[model samples]
Target: MVFGANSIAFFMFAGVVARLLIMWPIGETSLKTWLFVHVFRPLFGSLNGSLLFALSFLVLSYIFMYWLYRKRIFWKV
Candidate 1:
């Protein structure tokens, strides 16, 4: 479980860096729009123009972890 969580965190951090690289060069307005369309619309139906993909990913990951814990299933080594 610990190792799984660590790997998840590491990959998530790397994803954040990648998102920044993609979003930053295009400017804030474009980034915000892209995030809303790509990340928010798919999951929630409503647009989340304010939150970026990294932040949304973190929130979703936490929710998923909680669900997994409730089910008493952890990734085995």
Candidate 2:
């Protein structure tokens, strides 16, 4: 079934909350390290790659969730 706008909004809200919970334990420096080791260092090879990777992932995740929302694939619960 197709979801209403409010449903999609709530799904986005839940996603943000879940993301925060997941990141809370990782901490800032570790997060940067993780990003650098797995993603940034290989692709961009810049000291600032972690920051760029984080920003890009943020934008990409939003776009991905929006695409899923358009497909009526987001969780309702």
| lDDT tens readout by residue for model 1, 1-77 | 53365455446655775567466644545565576667677776663433545576567666666666667656544
Give the TM-score (vs. native) of candidate 2.
Answer: 0.38
What does candidate 2's lDDT look like per residue over 1-71, in tens digits? 22353465546755775466456545554554566677787887776786687677667656666677777
Error of 2 at 13 (Å): 13
- Tell me which residue pairs clash in candidate 1: none
> Which stretches of candidate 2 lie above 4 Å from their native place?
1-47
What are the RMSDs of all candidates, in order? Answer: 7.6, 6.1
Give residue 10's error in model 2 in angstroms.
11
Give lDDT: candidate 2, residue 6. Answer: 40
TM-scores of the models, in the given order? 0.38, 0.38
Q: What's the CA error at residue 61 for candidate 1, in Å?
A: 0.7
| Candidate that scores best on lDDT | 2
